[model samples]
Target: MAATIIDVARRAGLSTATVSRALRGLPNVSESARARVQQAAEELSYTVSPIASQLSSGRTGAVGVVLPFVNRWFFGQVVSGIDSVLRANDMDLLLYNLGDTRVHERFFERMPVRRRVDALIVLTLPLSEDETRALSSLAVPVAVLGEPTPPFWNVRIDNSVAAATAVRHLVNLGHRRIGLITGAAHDPRRFATPILRRDAYRTALEAAGIRYDPRLEAMGHFGIEEGAAAMAQLLTLPEPPTAVFAESDEMAFGALRTLRRMRLRCPEDVSVIGFDDHETAHLMDLTTIAQPVVEQGALLARLVLKALAGSHEEPSDTVLPTRLVVRGTTGVARRDAAPGVPPSPGAATDNGTGARGARSPVP
Candidate 1:
């Protein structure tokens, strides 16, 4: 039969309560008793029951992560970061993926995570007033990754600034006719990130003294296949754009694929840039606005821990920084390169940095 606390207490020559307190590292147990309990536990291979420990402490020993899409690369990276911190702290993770509308609605209606986790981490999902109230009623620490929800800890990057930097990069490369592939147009949930990015794209164009043409904007809906279709649609325009800025690297990958299928050379024909310097962006030589994806998640987890520990008094917002990563996918626009035609092989490949060398891959 497996060893239990009783066996450990008997072998240690101490009361069961003393053995339990020593094993749990609770105060009031002397060093001698703790050593004896440790030796006895090792000798009998005895371990405390996690269920019993949780019941006694009234803590589930888990953090709940609620996100819209678990399958997306960005979300996966964030979750990995969150899990790393939580795991190191001896805590478990419970994921709630509200990808489907029905599931999202049901989650708020049922409030399943109530009393099931010590804290909650919410990712970029726009919450309604009622839904926000429902989450608040859980009475646990909540940290959000996007916009600041008053009374909740928040961590995020400035979407408007990062997105504007991407469009401005293309404009500085001498591209007048720029296209935008955005996810906001088709999102039923009205996620704040996509909307902010799309608006920034328009504002950047105006700042560059360029007219904002709706025809140059396509609905990518934040998916690879959707991005490809959106790129194809832009190519069908009467006067297609000389460069394209995709709101996500996954969508940028699709745009690159479409360019390849059409036998059009990147930068030489249609320069491309993306947001979120995803892991594969370097492999694809994509220029993008790099946000600290994993670090944001780790920060959110740390904030939740601080709140749970009673160290964090008031709700706080932490906005991480973002930078532009230049790579081979974006370069100086060829003035004579027309739609459906690639520039001459000897055309300048300057990446708008005034340097005339091979573009180095982004790490």
Candidate 2:
């Protein structure tokens, strides 16, 4: 049978509270006492119960991660990084997937994770000012993975910069009428990422002396199907764009599929670019702006763990770098011909970029 905390206390000739404090590395316990408790526990072959230790120390030995969607590729990669860190630290992970708006409302209204986790990590969930204030009032330390809000530790990439870079690539390829396919925003005024990326798209076009054409923009839910549908809408316009930039790799794939369905060749007919250098980007020969998605998740977990370890210092905001990867999808703009020109029968075909949101190798 395993020895309990009482047995260690008795062996070390100390009170149960002192044994608990020393064994758990809580402050106010002298180093000599801590050494004595360690020796006694070793001799008795006693192991501390994580649950009891947490209870006495006012901790839960777990971190809660709340995300808008768990099934998505980006979220999956982030969760993998966070899970790896938690496992090494002997802490458990409690995942709360807010499936939709109703779930988000209910979760925030209750704040069910209160007292259930030692720390919390929120992954790019757009919240209102009221909700943000409510979260700040929670007892546990909070870390966010996108756009840093006040009083919270954050690790994120500049969405606007990434978007601008993607646009610049298409513009440099001599694409005059560039179309944009981006995620739909519920509220454009929430100061969220969709708005930032969209605004950046327009800014980049204007800087290049190109007019921001409303007819050249399409909205999607950031899914492959939605992207394909949106691309179809842009393609049917009287003056279709010479190139298109999708806000995400999945959307880019959809656009590619649409072009293929229409028997139009990429770059030869329409250039396609996307953000997020997904694993399969190389496979599909996609040109995209790559961000450190997995690293962001790992960093968020590290911040939460540091706070849980009695480090009261606030961590500085971290902005990761992004780079544009040129692959097969993007090419020099083709000469203008009659509107809606299809590719020749012998036009070269490239592989489609299927969704492979694997953990990106950190540079």
Candidate 3:
């Protein structure tokens, strides 16, 4: 039969309560008592019940991760990173995917994770005032991934700077007319990332002395199909842009597909750039703004652990750095190509500019 705490207490010649306290490394237990309990536990092969330990410690031994989409590549990577840290620390992860509007509302209304987790990690979801209050009422340590919410730990990259770097790369390549494929324009959730990137795109264009043309911008909603449709729409415009910046690699893949279907060569006809440097970005040969997706997730987990340990430090807002990774997808604009007209079929590709190994400085 498996040995229990009672067996350990008998072997150590101590009361059951003292054995429990010593085995848990709790205070009020002398060093000698702790040593005796440890030896007794080893000799008797006794183990403490995880449930009982949690009950005595007043902690759930699990962390809750809340995000919009679980299936998306970005979120998947982040979760993996978080799980790595938590698993190493002997803790559990409870995921809450609030992808659907009803589910999101229900989660906030029910407050299911209130006492079930030791801490919470929110990923890139824009919370309303009521929702924020609801999360605060949970009384758990909270960390946010994308935006800085006061009184909560935050870990994120500079979206505005990253987006501007992508646009500036194309402008430096002598592309006067640039297009933007973004997910923020019509999103009801009002996610902070897309909005910041969109505003940066406009600001970058103005800085480059290019006119802000609404017709050059299309809403992809950060999906492959939506990106394909948005690309087609941009191609149909009277004066199509020679370069396009997609807010995500998935969307950029769709744009590349659209270019193939229309028999237009990348860079030679339409230079395309994307963000996130996703796993498949290199396979697609996409130029993008690369952020440390896994690192950000791991940092957030560390911050939560610190908060859980009763760290008195002020809530930290950590903004990680992003870099421009130039690949084959972006190139110099065709000098001979006129506005409102596509370049000639025989036009040579401008591979010298924005080629692989070329990197734009992130400001």
Candidate 3 per-residue lDDT over residues 1-363, each given as its tens digit? 999898898989999999999888889999999999999999988888898999888899999999998888889999999999999899999999998778888999998998899999999988888998898898889999988887789999999999999999999998989999998566678788999999999999999998899999999988898899999999998888899999998889899888877767887788899999998899888999999999988998998999888898888899999999999889888666686356554445444555532222110
Q: Could you tell me which 10 consecutive residues in candidate 2 have the lowest summed lDDT? A: 354-363
Better of 1 and 3 by TM-score: 3
Instruction: Give the per-residue Cα lDDT of candidate 2 at 37.
Output: 97
Supply candidate 1's per-residue lDDT for 21: 92
The list of candidate 2 runs beyond 4 A from truth reads 1-46, 187-191, 336-363
| Ranking 2 against 3 by lDDT, winner | 3
Residue 147 of model 1 has an lDDT of 93
TM-score for each prediction? 0.89, 0.84, 0.90
**Model 2 score (lDDT):** 0.83
| Model 2, residue 225: C-alpha shift (Å) | 1.7
Residue pairs with backbone overlap in model 2: none
Q: Give each model's clash number.
A: 0, 0, 0
Candidate 3 ranges with C-alpha deviation above 4 Å: 10-14, 29-40, 344-363
